[model samples]
Target: MSTDGVGFGVPWQVSAFQLPAEAPGAAELVTRIRELRARILFDGGRRPDFRDGEDYVDDQELDFGAWHFVGRREADGPPVGYVRLSTPQTGRLFQSRAFLGEGPFEDLLTEEGLGTAETFEHSRLVVEHRARKLGLGVHLNAMAIAAARCLGAKAMIGTSGTADGQDLFHERFGFRPVPGTRRYVERYTEDVVLMLYRAARGAGEYTALVEQLEPVFSTITVTPERALGDLPRAHGRAGSSAVTIPAPGADRRMDAEVWRPVLFEPQRAEDRGELDALLASGQVREVCDTIEEQLRELVRSREPGRKLAGAELERAVGEQLAGVDPASYGVWAWYPWSGRLVHLLPREEFRLVRTDRNRGRIERPQQRELMARRVGVIGLSVGSSAALTFAMEGIGGAFKLADFDDLSLSNLNRLRAGVHHMGLNKCVISARQMLEIDPWLDIEIYPAGLTDENMPEFFSGGHGPIDLLVEECDTPYVKIAAREHARRLGIPVVMDANDRGLLDVERFDLEPERPLLHGILGETTSADLLDLTFDQIVDLILTMVDRERISPELAASIPQIGKTLSSWPQLASGVALGGALTAEAARRILLGQPRPSGRFYTDLELLTRADRSTVA
Candidate 1:
């Protein structure tokens, strides 16, 4: 059962055993194969009438004359693929006899002048889903066919499931569907076709395979493992999904695991192979082809007055890229969460073209200074928009996002997300959106949300301390705690109430002694805020934002909290404005502008008042 073999130049250990085999390890191997069949065919494939079980076996599997062929990637590896070959020597008839009835089954054999002794049936082919793209199915099929030929059989027969192109795969090996034998099987819940392969009309890949294995058919050791090097190589790569398939019960919330994107530089030879294989894996849903577009912008940024149009712009881009190999020109950024491979200009050039539109408003020196800063954001609801806005404006080259709550249907009113993102952590959703905007951004997410343990790391991790903090969470303790840390670390903080368009900026970097929330909560610490009643916390937030100036709509909605309304009222318009306001204030503060610690308002309702007069 430990026979070493070669299949199409891939080293594989092939094993074969008759039912009721008493050899050592034979029973265990059979059990493993049965379990794989049950899980893949019965459970995952949704075959009917099969209860969840550890193993699957039909009456045909118990026949002493039936033989099983199993293939494994390693000598000691568990079986990854299997196929069964049954002959007439078994006392029981073929499984297909029941489907076609004895009359039609025997009549078809007689019409072809085939005798029972010279014919065999192959069925029960199964391959692991992860290994399907690696040509394991073809190898297993070749093993079954080679063994059947070695056993002196002149013809092969099998009932192939027509679902998922299984019958078509068999056709490549010279199996022809027996006329009028295609019918649906209740157990499989799919149409099945009886296929036949005769020795006299030898054809297809199976014929070449049997001939290739003829020399090693009698020998057990398949030496120089590349024995089947003459065979055509299989197409496609295995396990190529951009999003890695997690192991059973694995925790997917680890921020470092799923949220970060990997960059592949073409300079390394090994990375080139890896990138080529990745592209061939079919896992990347979208490969951003904006390299030339960005290149055109790069040229425009250097020569702003040059008017290159149509083919002229193309020629300029071509001239710039003339000496560079297309594959090695720019780096590729792969985002696993979204399965997007983005081709971008080298880091410096990418930022230059990205922030080109802000040339006049944000001078080159100011923009460069802003891009060097790091920002930490807590509470991803409104914070999601703020983080994305910061990215688009090139306000920060690195960001630390924190959010313990998931995106819910109710939060969709103001948050920038779709229904598919409902169950995802807000930090993850925010990081993904920010990365999509600028793949070169250094982003770290706290899916568990902001906590005492991670608060320090959020402010200052391996990438160095953040220059600015944006406090946006509803939790009173976190709000106070984040500000306390910011004051101690000399990091500036900004917040948008999403009501009355109130944008709160605290220049802790300049005034570390500034009382929390402008002394609204005098002598209050995060610990004190933690134990306050829900209403007390709400009052604290209201007082900090100036309760008297609260918007009319929000003032009315406050009494409805926990009674008629589930939460405070917020509109998309307010959230959008909050992002814009925060981004503007952050830019000025990071660049050492004279924006002081205070709460400013741009309330649209008041600003766009119907009857407004100039105040002298």
Candidate 2:
């Protein structure tokens, strides 16, 4: 019933990684594993004919076409244990075939009627001495099985030494001897046994073990397929159509896992052509340079009066950027709409502009609480601004965005986008802006917009339920329609009028039976509001928005629809101000602060009054 930060049911906090040989920390990982193995395997007098170094036996050649998983405690610590899963069709299970005599492992598999195509090999499950007693051995084996399952392996074959009771350990963990493969060994003066554990695709003797490992599987999964924009899981043995390359403009989206490696991969390959061309155009350099400059400013603010020489700053920032692996972050996201990369990794100790300033104001724990909140935004005109602000402050764990409208030229005055995004969907544009700020923030797009047919599903908790709903739609029907779902799900609803900064907070979570919109429209159903005339709709909106307290300009401009103005007046200033106010309110409400159901005004007229105090 207990869980760690990542929801893994382990004795100690552990980070499970499946990294390639060329991954950022792969070299250090390889060295650590080798050292640990040497300390344990050769701690005695010496192993017989061990060709590897006196300290460790590192089959570095085996690293090719193999995935390595290293387990570390408390993140940022030395690897406590390591395992390797290799999906090979031709190669024998490392020196095991010779011991069993003339491909005996494969013959044994054939005799068992299990094909070798869907089979893989797991080996080198070594754990450090200090870390061994904490149930890491069992965890490492469980995670190795998880990795095997993730890679679509139906079974695994390996050889274990009998000297340290490893063979007994493997047998205890569902690994059975290959009937006649147990034999005395000359390799290390220790007996060895070839073992087999069948994952069996969907059903196997180890079905219960697989079922029990569900939680660990979900936690330690390395979703390379989903991470690489829309890359399909590659199948087939070795060379028979085992790879697929994304086409042009297809690599626009990049999640945290895929973004870093995809970016660092050289541009000469045609498979990486989209990014190759972009990098050649000098975009990446320009972007990283701008980010580095901001990081410098952060350093200045963090330690006032401290400065670095121009050359020294460049070298320091350059090294830091090189180490900025987006895949190393806790949260990551991909936004195809705006074509940007986002991750939560800190470089130069500067995450965002408010790093030092927000330390005392918001505090790390408070920000973490805010980040754990799941928010849904239903309208992009104002909701887009709110989403962007929330992302800038890292205030949402995930987001569900719904807006059916496309970005037209007229929307540029209020929406935070340039002319390049003119024809894109409003939700997509908002998502892009949010992702550009923090790509690791999870986002779901309702491209066709929210409807009654899909609203229930939208509010459902698959990843997690919508914690709070921000309703900013102008359509009278949707405004009430969204609240109906919010009320049913007990989700708090926040909306910004973007005029006089009227932020409406409906604490449906606090008052579950509270009437939709506090019954202000007198049970105004969506169907009933749909039949009203445009003038009636205007009157309904004004009544709901409290026209009595609206800004002088907004009040004057509301009634002049079609006569003086083309539509209800909306200003860039008002929209931006509404975004800032709504974000602040949402953070408080999500944190369970005392923001009860009410309409609060951030009226500029009242705040910047002529009789205001002259304090600078």
Candidate 3:
């Protein structure tokens, strides 16, 4: 029945025993009972001969089959502790009657009264003295309770000796003595305490108790005691009697597992031995398998159609890249083995395919190579459209995009692309669109746009300064600023004003001071001019275009009417004509062809006019 001082490192087996059927055998069952009693009396230091004449076994087996729980240090080792249970029995044995002294048993068992029905008696819990302080008593008691419940007992009753042990049952495990019970057990001892545990009451009460114990059982440490003010002083006063508080700062402090990489300095080579040992053990493999399983589940949930193949897939991916201009194509390489994607080259490295077959000189060339030209676009709206057109035209050179507004849903109506590009700043989006058109095109993105703060940076110094500044913005101040800045920086500025089917161009680089077209329009500061209400600006432009009106059809196509011209058919024609005229002006500037240096206006209305010269 003893472990013989065996160390605690080895595992132990715990088993449950069911009482035998039929009449008790004094030779076999009584012998086992005596052996159990001897173990309890000799090793556990309990009174010898606690039960006589097979009375305990005879009563338990006949009335209600008794179940025994045995804990052994090894598979074949003897029991170290045990507890007994009895089926429902009325009268003196029932703690309810003993505690109450006088009770209508039927009424006492109802919810209107004591709220108890069937009850079992818990008796004879004993542990070897060596295991007494080691939780064997607690273990045996818990086993008895569990066995009682398993046997369909609705309640459990017991009496405890008036000693310190009774306090353990009452305080630690929530068992309470029944009221008015001193007289009933006076025969045994005046101090004997009667206790009853209604299974239903215990079940409901324990649910809440278990809830309170859950965090403790789960080992979840909340705020650390050190993090709590006065905790140290309180602990010092209590000394050994104080509840053991978890280490100060231990619970609240960031867990090294989750946040060490972010907060702690990297471990030195000499300090990683423990980590290396952990990895060398099977722990690292387990963690990796868990992570892989989670990742596989995630991938299956999100992209069930995507398959990860081996080297053959890599070869296939490489083959797919054939004929793709490495410079033009944004090549993103994915390593299937590692699940990482890397950008293979800078976006600008791609060489644009020369769409123009005619390498020789052509008269009045409509296609101007952007490579030999420096074009600065002042706004990404009309400017972005112009840049894309210039790129598509194989104007293979440096182009500057300047705009402060980020791409928004409103811009999608006239601007290229869609909602996928909503959040990007116009300068970035326009530059990206140009790169997509001709990756070899030189692009300069002015994230701040053409403000006076960044004017010099875009115009004269740093990287590619402006050669031809295009003022596509409707801002009059920007128009003035662009012209003045370009003049001061010795760069040309071009701008297109789309009015109905009319594209008006002001070539400030060619004619710096011909009263600066904005000046000719009698507008000085862009802020002052754009301050005119939207409707007012539209009305003024309409008046300007109407003055040189050639036909009503062309006049109606102009955006000078604002939202009134909501017809897509009309808007599309105007935009196409505007883009064409803008492109033509850009071509003229880039080709060094004879063109108006001050301002030029092209009217689609004049196409129907017999007097084209007058309109021109």
Candidate 4:
């Protein structure tokens, strides 16, 4: 009856709703999803009772506050795919935590002061073999992500199967392997991986998907009002014993004016007894001794191999242990983007991993100089990637962004976001992506998009005067309009067109009166082209960029702009490379290095010609 994302002459109607276990067709839908999952997971129909039994991992209790998606060829047809998002409480009882024991999940929730009321679980995602090519998996995941965000959840985590390589598929939607929990599932028959996606707090594969599919997501996601209702209690409460999660608002960071030793415990108080028993055993003693010995050796390696041995070394070790408390040993800092809790190390020590590689290349003073500079980026379609690369590499201390356009389905082919972010301003989405990378980072946004009136304010120091500008807008008016302001403000400009690696750099700082685009279009000022027709605009852009030298694909796509294709073709790889190239140029320019303004091409086809010559 519908054909939203269907192909191959199959009209698939995708419906999203919270189906009560007692609903008219709920039981049958669950059976179809379960039977399909069983076949996929175990290679046959594994009944509910058998070890390799049917994957009927569903029930009403688990569906509380959850959204279920069922895709069919017709109104009365069997489901081609199904995916359920678990409610907050049910997410706490997620299988990965139940079987693998609580890890950073409990720690993460503790640090954020979140409860089951602010979490989600992606459970029971299955698609029939025949429908795999119809793009149903992407639709289901996108809808589920949107639904979770709608229900006021901050993050979603779930267990994925490694047996059928679903882990890789999950990565496409931005789900990453939970940092420390990877092990066998159900008596070692299959490997299970815990995956998580924190809504904001970093750029990731899934975040982009969410942004790309935002339009579709807005239509399919069910709201919490209709999804949550009276249902059976959760089957497995995650933390019911002594080592339980404290009720929200209870202070665990301190007690009686003393720092409490935080522990990564998410089980019941009774379960602590089992852990105490294990800690008391000879086995644990051996493990502790092994770790202590390794620590001693590490000190020796760095401390000129100072050999502290015999009673003398034991005395020193005891002295060192006496000054430290057990609680101070494993305090983890949570990184919400990756759902990883990294053990806190010295700032310099932790940063050394990247700085060491940059030492001789970037030099210490230049590294420090780069981090102190403020940069602004426009046009988040490609600008998002550039901004993130700058943040990840510690290239900028502050950032300002501008974009009036909301995320559309077409943008997802490159931008990092999910269905939940659909309809959001591009600037807001990019800024969120940047902040997720570094919460302390200072970022400003221009929601209304850049204009003649605000262009001056955008260039001057509002947050901080931008030392560099990465212009990536598609509007020819803004593109030229931005350079006019940058030239007057003496700011360097860098941009990449994401085709044939055409990077156009304008060093307005050096040549204040230099003709725009190196005078390629006959001294035409931004004002001169303000009233051009669409054909004139297209002709101006083509002539400015030298269409004769562009790649064959780009040249072909240009003339068909409003014909076969709605827009120019762009690949993720090209956009990513453009980001890296722009960052590299910006870094050099910011450091006062010799990166004078000019056009540069890192054409893949041209570079490969040398390789082909060598191969031949």
Candidate 1 has which clashing residue pairs, if any?
A: 403-449, 404-449
Question: Tens digit of lDDT per residue, candidate 4, span 383-409?
Answer: 888998998777887888888788888
Best by lDDT: 1
The TM-score values for the models, in the order shown, are: 0.60, 0.51, 0.39, 0.47
Ranking by lDDT: 1, 4, 2, 3
- For candidate 1, what is the lDDT? 0.73
Tens-digit lDDT track of model 2 for 1-616: 1122122233433344454656665665555545555444442323423224333454455554566555655443445566777776434535455567766666776887777677788887876433433346656676678667876777788889763457766776577777666665544444577888876543233345445665565475442221112211212111111011122222222111111112222222432443344434322323232444555655456455557658866665555556653333222222223233333334224354544566766876787788788889988988888888888876786888888888889888878888877777787677656656554456766756776655765687324578988898888888888888888878899888887778898999899989887677886777787777898889989888877888888877876889978887787888888888888888888877888898888888788997885875
Q: Estimate the TM-score for candidate 4.
A: 0.47
Candidate 1 residue runs with Cα over 4 Å from true position:
1-257, 310-312, 612-616
Selected candidate, larger lDDT, 1 vs 2 = 1
Off by over 4 Å in 2: 1-356
Q: In candidate 3, what are the lDDT values of residues 1-616, reduced to their tens digit?
A: 2222112222323345444444354245434543554434321111213333322222223222444455544544445555666665333455445445555444445633433335677765655432332334544565456556655666676767542234334334446666655331322221456665655555332334333332332121112111111211111111111001111122121111010010000133321332343234232222211222222333333333566456644444455445553322343322111222223232322221133332343221334444667777888776776777777665537776777787767667787767766766777666656654453455656655676655665676433466676677755567676776776665655555555444555555556565555454564544555467766665554443444643555455555344665432324345556666677766766677766654455655656577755654
lDDT of 4 at 590: 89
The true-structure Cα RMSD of candidate 1 reads 17.9
Evaluated at residue 582, the lDDT of candidate 2 is: 81
In candidate 1, how many Å is residue 607 off?
0.6
Query: Which parts of model 3 are misplaced by more than 4 Å?
Result: 1-352, 358-369, 522-570, 598-616
Candidate 3, position 136, lDDT? 49
